[model samples]
Target: MKNKVLLLTWSALITVVLLASLSFARQGTGLIGNVFSDFNDFSWQLDEFYDIVGPTKLNSIDVEEAKKNITVSDDEIERHRYRYGTLADQLSNIHDQYAQRIADAKDAGNELLMNTLIEERDMKLADIRKNFESDAHVEAKIRKEKEKALVQYLNDVKANSFSLPVAYEFTDVETGETYSSGDVSVPAVYKKQFNAAKGYFKANSLPGHNGTNGWIRTSDYGNQAASEDIQITTSVKTFEGTVIVPKSAVAKGGVLYSQYKDFNKGRLATYVFWLLGIIALITLLTVMKFQKEWVTGTAIADWYADLKIDLKAAAFFMTALILVGYIDSKSSNLSNFFTYQSLGRWGEWLTSFLIGGVVMTTLFAFQLVNGVERWKREGVLAKDIKNSFTLQFFKALREMFLKRSIGVQSFILLIGFFLAGIGFIGGFIDGIFLMIYAFCVLFLGLPALYIFVRRSAYLNRIIVATEQMASGRLNEDIKIEGRSPLADHAKNLNNLREGVRISMTEQAKSERLKTELITNVSHDLRTPLTSIITYTDLLKDENITSEERAKYVDILDKKSQRLKTLIEDLFEVSKMASGNLELNKQRVDLTQLLQQALAEHANQISESGLDFRTTIPEEMLIAHVDGQRWWRVLDNLIVNAVKYSLPGTRVYVTLRKVGDSAEFVVKNITKFELSENVDELFERFKRADTSRHTDGSGLGLAIAQSIVDMHQGNMKIELDGDLFKVTVTVPTK
Candidate 1:
């Protein structure tokens, strides 16, 4: 229930965020408006100023005469500063100085001084004019002076201090003669009249000269030559108009309009309201579904957590979308309405939300289903849920799948259908159809394939079981369930299991019988041998009287000794079979040890009437073994060979180093049946002949095999009819 509530909350939050982003995208344009307003204000001010100043007019004679007579040097021009210094004052000083020079010249009658003074004054004037014409500061200064002069002229014109001239002399460039001709000459008269009109200008400065309409003064003389015509070419002052409009009004093409032509303003409010309604509807539906699922006990905590995470992701995406859309709407290059349209944009948001939600939910559901299936298949009991790790995991998984199943499936299907429709309409009908076909194949065919695969796997398991039964091993229990042919085969496997059990029981019984028979025989032989040894000891007393008694005593001693040897051999064989014998291992130099052993048996070898051939290396061949037991093994093999070997034939005792082990071999020509398998000669009481004619107790090889085993070595016998050979291999450390 808690999980369901959380999921609903997450869904609601994501929807709100996406809707808010779309709303913001539609309405935001403050930056665009501010930029346009600033530009329009600047342009409007410039236009108004241009209208007030009008155009400048220059007299042809004045311009032509000024161009021809004005000559200024580079140094003089550079030194001129019309903007910073007082022009009126400087001009007055020049005029006064020139006047004084003229007075002095006239008084003394010095023409040279006066001429020089006049030339200097002309140069100064030419310099000032050039500076004012080219320098921006000087141009600005001239404009300021013209504004002042224009105001004075306007005042003079208003006061009637200036008379309008009809005609004046216009100079001819070639002859320098005056002519009263056409309107060209009339412009010259207007120039003179404008100069004369300065009489009224000297009285007062006009208002509005620094502000808008101030250029009216310059415009009043329609045909008059402007003062400082080259300098005061244009007005610098600008006039501004107050704009009155609603705050909502947007500007377009330098004009503000009450309504936006691009966006459907009338429908915008309705659309926003409708979007809100839709969001609310979705929220309500989601909440109700959550409540329903919760009541039905299907809500999962993990699903709820995933839903919350997905909601946060959606929120982030919506925020980025809103920011980008807002920026796009404010940009000048792209259309605002096209950039901010909510229908297509919201559709995309919805699609993304559905896709993300479905994916998360589906993943969670799959994990849950898999876990639950594993637990159920393993036969985990419900009662052990608290104790079993598997049970708890399955429970958690089940809850996750059940709670989110419907919501996840619905979301996926909706998104899938929406994408399909979009693709179909986007000239991809074939792709849409293909997607549908693939989905069908995956959804329906996959389950069928799963069922078939499962059936095959079950059959394969049964076949494997049957094959195991066919082999010797049938101990495994076949616990397969069902009434199929494979199940019946499994039953047959169980029957095989019972049969194997019975056979193993019978084999165990036979092994026990064999062990009992050997134990009883050995014990019985020991008892009789004990009696004979006791009798032989009694008979060895000095009280025995004659040769017959001596003979009887000899027989008794021989029988006793033979019986003792037989009993000891039986005991040794039994101990070996039971694995009770032990070897005391030490590092023994095989060459030295073999020499010592051969020396101990040297007298016996000589007395046996057989030629004993001993070949061994002088170099030390070390082996890790029981020295005493290994010596005894060699002793038994050589003695047995000498006993059975044909008299007067050679007996060979050869020892050699083979890899990491030493091989000791004793071969002799013997008169024994060699038909028996040589390897089986190591078994207890295994003899070549049924009759006990040989002196050996038939346990020599068995004892040797046991001793070798204890030393972690190997012993074997090889027979070639009357030529028999025994070999013992002891490992070196």
Candidate 2:
């Protein structure tokens, strides 16, 4: 506890000292800049006094000297002659300038102003007509007008008092013209000590004159001219001047130089002291003990970090406002510290407010440092804002807008309620109005309430159906009633339920196939083994004849060959099922391959007592497939037909181009019933010879389908009672 207290104290001390240092640097001089700038406030006051007084003093002499050269030039007369253009243009300009004013005066019942404006327009028009073409007349008029304006300017300057606590003397360098005012004999030592004014001549002392002189045109024309209606030229006079600040003026204490000297004392020393104090405090705070305890994070930091982002931002804004107040007060005080100026009643209140603000800002600064350290260790502002309620609410709004129907409906409902609230506000006027509002609510609100309740119940139904589906009860589907959003949701739920049903059925079928697979494999292997074992026992009896031994041995050899064929076929089918079988695919003429398969089985087809009806295409139907695998496919289909077809029944083999595919179809009347599902015939070890009388391994169709599928083609079986058909379709291109 003691460490935390000391840490906070040291932190607050550092904040106060640092802020004070900044305030002084800003209001006085900067840390590494001119030390004399600490007295800039007094310097500014001195400069302001000189600026306001110097121009007034200089203008009097400048105007007096300029009035001597108030002569009009030929160019000035010509410009003034064409100032308003032709006679017609002059009349139009006059009308445009005063037409509205005259109308306004007449409307306001000011007949004097109306008549005066009319007279003035007439005078200007008459002047333009009389002097429009006479250059000499215009020049005479311009000179008279300039002299008249110069007299008026001199009179105005005389009326205004431009008193100063100094004396000035000027002498023209080229003409030796003297212009002096007040005491010109003041001591030269006092002039040098005070730096009262520049003694050298400035080229451009008059307004609007650079280093050259020109005719001073009036503002009526767009030339930059003299001010105050004083029409005169600068006349190119260079004057050397000296302003003398007397010791009497300096001793008076209210003059600018006196005020500056009085106020400038101890300003630099104050700044240096403040800078050293801040540096010392910074060093002390840096090496302070237990800094990690409170400078890292404290209870206040935890409280701030736990605040909502909006609240934290608001606190930071308030802290900023307080910091601004502190800086303003500190600067205001430091800038006037030596001036001894009082702000009257407001100053006390402001000082108290600023003290409180300073304390608050210092504490905020301490907490801000600690909070920043804590936030860096945890995460930045993005992490906090991500978990903020404002972001979450906006995220929800964004998701709602993804489905525009729901968003629009929700907005409409909100607007309806908001307008309804406004309508209810009128119910406060009278009790009868309240009763009317109640009736209106019942009339409109009932139907809306019914819709809300119905949708809620429908949503509940969908939820219940999803729950049942999750628990593996997919028999029931959601009942869709309307075309609303809720109804659409119910339809999707029903579709999902159907998909789950199909998946469950396929799973059961797979289980059944697995069981049948084991049974068939065991029976098939055991029968061959039994035959081999029985025949071997007969051969072992030496009493048997050679013909009997040879016959038993032949039986054994046939059984072993059957077992080997079964094992090999099983392994190949397994490889195909597990996707481990690789095919060597190439472009081959499928028509020739089909004919070759039939040629290979020609003897079997002839001996089976089956009538073979072949419809092989003479043209080549090319396809990309593994030739060896594709031949196996055709061989299996043909062999199956020959083995299973009833005696003397006709077998059909057809190969033709069908659309984008090359289709090979074989049809036969089966000796046994194909009552099983057509799709189940594609399962391994499943055959039409359920009694196990034939040597058929039941993998023929399965292997054919796997090979076709590997080539990105199709194999399908169609059964019509005892008539079975198998079709293989592969892409021709």
Candidate 3:
């Protein structure tokens, strides 16, 4: 499960990376500007051609005329300097007036006035500078200063320019007859000048009128202009057929020179080859990984099942990936093979498949070996290889596919594939680093989460079971089974449950046996003691006995009878508790039982000088219970009430049907401080009163409790101030 989860996580990570990389790779860098700038050699060549070829002719004419005209003297030089200084001062004074007017307008918050003044100032200043610089000798000096600027502008133009050989068709404005540029020929001088300018204009296809009538002149046509009405047609040509020219020859339609079609084609081929090589390497690695079988000392059948599942999953995943790639390639304009995007997608899918398969296979193998060994001693496997393979295959398939063994296996495969794909895509060192990082996070974090959840649930179940056991409800079954650690813990919990049940059962049995032994011994002793007490009483009552003899005999008879009754009660209590004595249940009247018990204790109650009262409904209160046992219950309560009641205090017995049960309650006011713990009085051999006035056994209430339990009724004792109460509730028919 851990490996499976890891595989899934790894697969997801690889998928994300694959998508991200493809997205990044598709966006070409904006480095064309930098490349153009860096190749300054191209710019310089163009600059030199324009300056030496075009501007040289104009400069020569000016220089030759200057040489024929005159020589400069000191006076002329001084005069020229004075004129230049005067023009500069006048220009500065005009700028001050403009600046003052603009500042004042801005301070007054008059934006309109400020803008107007600034525009007026700029126009006046330009007029003044132009007038000053346009002088013949001044222009000569300016031209010298503008040389570098001219070269730089020309370089910018050349470097920024590109042109395609479009199939041009020109239509005559007058005749509408189309003529191809290839078919037309004009003079070399006209062609050279026209073509240079036309080439430059066409290369830098600006979206504006280049001349009058909205028609641009070509470098091959010199100053000739075509009317806008004379439409020119053009079409795109493949790079293979497009002509390339030298930087110098490019200005005009001179012979085409430099060509890069073959070079670009070769470069593309190299790229494709390299891409295929990488893909092949990845494919080979994946195949090897898939072929490598994992050996786990688990049951062969289980391993086979797991292996079958992993393989099918892998195959399905790969098929899906391939299908998607094929569909995308067919539907889109993207290349069908060797694209960065396609490769990444394939890598991610392959990674997932390989990782899932490997992990599942490994786990399956382990489980299979284990299972096989477990069954080996039982002769589960045949020694024949053919039979083994057949068994293993079917078993493998069932476990792997039917049982969804793919869960853990898929996770493992995903993780492995993600790491491997990451490594493959990233290249050796970087890929390895990424793979390691991914593996650690997936293998560690996911498994930890699973274990945490599993253990938490397991602990919760255990706690609940423990609480039930603590509450004396030990008959609960805890059964947990799985490959998870929590499952093992659940087994332990189950064992603990059984242990607790066994201990409780044994303890209950021992208590029952002890109760039985005591009951039997006490009964045997009580019978003999009862006879002795009866004989002693009979003798004491005889008229022939002397006064001392009668008194001693009466004392002896009282003590003997007390002992006998105590013994009998103890025996009866034990018999009832241990389930050794069967009850003859019948429909007994609860009201009658209470009345009889109260009447039997009436003499004692009256002797004690306590008011005895009975409240029983006249209606028939029927309940299923042993009449003899119920009588005992009522007798014990009445006796207890009589003994505990204070002299002149009232003792009350109430019997009635309350809801679904018949309720019997005996309440009496006690002379002594009522015992703080009433439950203790229900124990065998226990007594509420230390005085021996009551010739009663403490086992009386205990026996009553046993009888009530046998009838599935509830008995309780309560004390309020000097009032002591015993209540019994039995189900009524």
lDDT of 2 by residue, 1-733 (tens): 7755675555445544655566676755443353322345534533443433322444333555666776667677767777668778877988899999999999999999999999998998888887776877887777666765655544544454433455667666677676667785755213421222544544333333543443433443333342223444433345676656555554446355545454544455456547765775867657653355554445666677777776767777787777667656654565345344456734864564445453564456655776576568655777878988789899999998776876877776677678678669868988887887787678765666676677778889889888989999877777888787778888888888888888988899889889989999899989999999999889889999999988998999999999999999999998998999998879899988888888888898889999999998878889888999999999999999989999998998889889999988899999988775887888888888989899898898889999999988998889888889988899978
Model 1 has a clash total of: 0
Measured on C-alpha atoms, candidate 1 has an lDDT of 0.55
Over 1-733, each residue of candidate 3 has an lDDT whose tens digit, in order, gives 4434543343333333333234224422321122221223334543443333222211112322322333334443344444535767867888888888899999999999999998888887786666555565544443332332333333433344223221223332334443333322321211222232344212111122222221222222221221111121211111111122223332334322222222233235434543543554465356423211233332543544444333534544665555345333322322222223446766864564344433333343344444455346644333333245566777775666543544455455567657656655665567667666667658764675675566577768877876886787766666565665556666776787778777987899769856854664565456547667666666756565586666667766766766667667766766776779898999888777777776777687778887777788998899999999889888878877777678887777788889999999888877677568776667665556654334556567788888899899999989787778888999985
Q: Estimate the TM-score of every prediction.
A: 0.33, 0.38, 0.31
lDDT by residue for model 1 (352-467), tens: 54444333333333334433443465544333344445556677757645636434544555566576566556545567677765675478545655755665788688777777
Q: Per-model C-alpha lDDT, please?
A: 0.55, 0.71, 0.54
True lDDT of residue 444, candidate 2: 65
Model 2 weakest 10-residue run by lDDT: 187-196
* Clashing residue pairs for model 1: none
Error of 1 at 665 (Å): 1.5
- Candidate 1 wrongly placed segments (more than 4 Å): 1-564
Candidate 2, residue 530: Cα displacement in angstroms equals 89
Name the top lDDT candidate: 2
